[model samples]
Target: MTVQEQYPARYYARYDHAATQPAPVTGWYDVWGMSDASSVPDAADLVALSAAQWSARTPTGLGVQNGQIVSYAPPAPTLAAQARSALVQAQAATWAKFGSLGKTVTDDWITYQQALSAIADGSNATATDLPSAPSS
Candidate 1:
């Protein structure tokens, strides 16, 4: 069994306030295992955040199109799909950065499946229930 399955978010949160070891304080626990109601950032939240950060930047080198499309042309069917994929890419990086961090990458990949399920639903767009944002 994987570490995350053995030590789910609740395990970390329960011991976060008292655990004296590094196991409960670093890595995923710090981000995906927060004390908040949701363990991770929703897809919508990440998308909006990424968009905001992207918007704040000034693109250089590329000549301005003026009246043409000047944004990153997404290859996904919906905004949710694009956002979800972006989240996956970030998660993969996180998995690679922290000694695999209790198999954090595997766990996030599983969670990504769930995010896709949520996004596929015909509900109103919101970031309230998306999975955690992966690393940069």
Candidate 2:
């Protein structure tokens, strides 16, 4: 089989008990294992298998237990994120004007603000056009 068929890109699990104590219980755990064989265990199957193997020697309601399965993936940032970042940088550059050394630094701050405003309004603005903050 090819790589996709041979291995799942992600696996998921849920827990019936807290893995650690002295804290509020969160009944879920997502495990990623080293290899295909280790990653393939279903949550319920894992629970049953563990119970069978350890029930004779272990106490009731003790040790690890799986509750269910859950899968999750994070989403990408939206256009608003870019606009927000540009706005923040523009505000910082505006503040830098108070400590500006000379006319060049003042002019650079103005150009930087213009570029940032263009980006925040969804217009094309090359980041390279923005100047560094004044050192003096």
Candidate 3:
């Protein structure tokens, strides 16, 4: 079935009118007309229709479905990501050295360097344990 076919008639009608309009109509009322106010589709119906249409038009896995975003989580970090993460951790550790916790920061910096070395050797164990930066 076509994407528009997936939604209710009111939605398809409103979408059809909007898609074809060269200039903005004041509202769906203006497009569908106001001969009988009782026949007007509720705003919510139109909204739902628009959302469904938008999702259908979006490439297969790229948009929201049933109110939740469709997203793919990467299974693992790439080598470049590992390297960048290690650099960020190292920088955080360096900055921490300026605080009162110099020794702890030094330890974390060492750990980050080890992780960076491991990443270079195609190992992810150490990188996985790299500490996050201190808040504030």
lDDT (10s digit) by residue, model 2, range 1-136: 5333443333332233544422222232223334344444444433322333322322222344233222222244544455567668666666655545333446666666666566566575444343344454
Q: Backbone clashes per model, in order? A: 2, 0, 0
Tens digit per residue, CA lDDT, model 1, 1-136: 4334433332211212232222121211222343453554332222111333334433332111221112332232575765566656655665676446664445655566556556645343675445555332
Instruction: Please give the range of 10 consecutive residues that has the lowest summed lDDT in model 1.
Output: 61-70
Give the least accurate 10-residue stretch of model 2, judged by summed lDDT: 21-30
Candidate No. with top TM-score:
2
* lDDT (CA) per prediction: 0.40, 0.43, 0.44
lDDT of 2: 0.43
Q: Which residue pairs in candidate 1 have backbone atoms (N, alpha carbon, C) closer than 3 angstroms, thus clashing?
A: 41-132, 42-130
- Which whole-number lDDT from 0 to 100 does residue 130 have in model 2? 37
- State which candidate has the highest lDDT: 3
Worst 10 residues of 3 by lDDT: 20-29
Select the stronger candidate by lDDT from 2 and 3.
3
lDDT of 3 by residue, 1-136 (tens): 4322333333322222333223222223332223344555554434343446443543222322333233323246766566767676666657666445644445555665666666656666434443443343
Q: After superposition, how far is residue 71 of candidate 3 from its true place, in Å?
A: 6.0
